[model samples]
Target: MNRAVHAVRRHAVMAVGVLVLLYLFLPVAVVVAFSFNDAAGRFNFSWQGFTLDAWRHPCRVPGMCESVSTSLQVGAIATVAATILGTLLAFALARHQFRGRASTSLLVFLPMATPEVVMGASLLTLFVNVGVATGFATIVIAHILFTVSFVVVTVKARLAGFDSRLEEAAMDLYADEWQTFRRITLPLAAPGILSGALLAFALSFDDFIITNFNSGTTITFPMFVWGAAQRGVPPEVNVVGAAMFILALGCVGGAEVWRRVRAARR
Candidate 1:
């Protein structure tokens, strides 16, 4: 009786897990399926036979390419800047203990913890007060500000688990701080740093709400999608979304593979 009950429970759990996965991925599956649809209207995903029309005819959709390009540029700039600043902040937080350290940590992580609407409004207010014109540059700066928190957290977690004696040993062997950090610390922590940056890039690329608030006339992919949805999305939006999803998945997979390879080598 117990064995039968156990089997029943296991099956029940598996069924629930499958349902949850489907619930999460069903929309994405539909989007991917419809990206190849011959129809022009995005809302009509009835699959009137598969064609690469959307992928090939991206130019037919007004502002699709421009939005994509803007998203890429903004994501790239924000990711780079956030990664550098966050990594440095992580290093400082991990290596040194100082007054207001707790406050510093809270401030660093505030962006991630705060509500998105609040952060966006606050940033918009700050920009207006400072007389900063809203555009791609402002959008990029806002993305970097919000995205850096994730990087800081990821890098700091790695640093927390790191053995500090490696750096000490390097120092004992006459290596300076810069050399020790570049040669020993960074090499060991590179996986986490890279992973953090990749994660940041993905977030920045996909962001909509904050980007919309900060962006004036500059349309990122999400903004384009929003505007297009007013008139009903073009089928090409599905293509673009699917492409971005695949690219992001590949980047994350690559980072994971690299981390595992480094670990096995070590």
Candidate 2:
């Protein structure tokens, strides 16, 4: 009777897990399905037919392609800048002890912890005070500010396991500090940095609210989607979103594979 009870419990646990997974993924699955939907006037899971016309008809919306291009440019530049700065900050926080360290850490994380609207409002105020005109540049700055926190946290976790003695021993062997860090610390931490960068890029690319507030007269993909939705989103917008989702998944999967490969080699 005890063995039968245990078996039943195991099955129950598995069933619950399966249900949770389905709940999470079902919406995404539905969206992808709708992207290929051929129904006119209304689209849903009940497939009226199948078509790829939506994917090919993005040109129907004026400035749609330009918005996508601008988003890519901003996300790429912001991610690069944020990753470099955040990785360096992570190294300093992990390796050095300094005054106001706690305060500094809190400040660094403020952007991530704060609500998007609040962050956006604050940035907008700062730009106005500084007389900085809003557009792609403002959006890039906001993206970097928010996304840097992710990079810092990720790289800091990797740094926790790092042995400073390796650098010390390298110094003992007549290697300079920079040389030791380049040869030892950097190689070990590269995977974490790379993963953080990919994550930052994904976040920046998908951002809508903060980008909307900071971007004045500059349109990104999310902005395009929002404006289109106000007029009832066309099927092609769904197609664009589906394509982005696939690309994002590919990037994340590639990062994970790279991380695993690095671990295996180590």
The candidate that wins on TM-score is 1
lDDT of each: 0.89, 0.88
Question: CA shift at 242, candidate 1, in angstroms?
Answer: 1.0
Residue 186 in candidate 2, Cα distance off native in Å: 0.8
- The parts of candidate 2 lying over 4 Å away from their true place are 1-4, 41-47, 251-266
Residue 119, model 1, lDDT: 88
Q: Please, what are the lDDT tens digits per residue for candidate 2 over residues 36-55?
A: 88857733436777898877
Q: Give lDDT tens digits, candidate 1, residues 134-177.
A: 99999999999999999999999999998999999999999999
Residue pairs in clash, model 2: none
Write down the TM-score for model 2. 0.88
Q: Which ten residues in a row have the lowest lDDT in candidate 2?
A: 39-48
TM-score of each: 0.90, 0.88
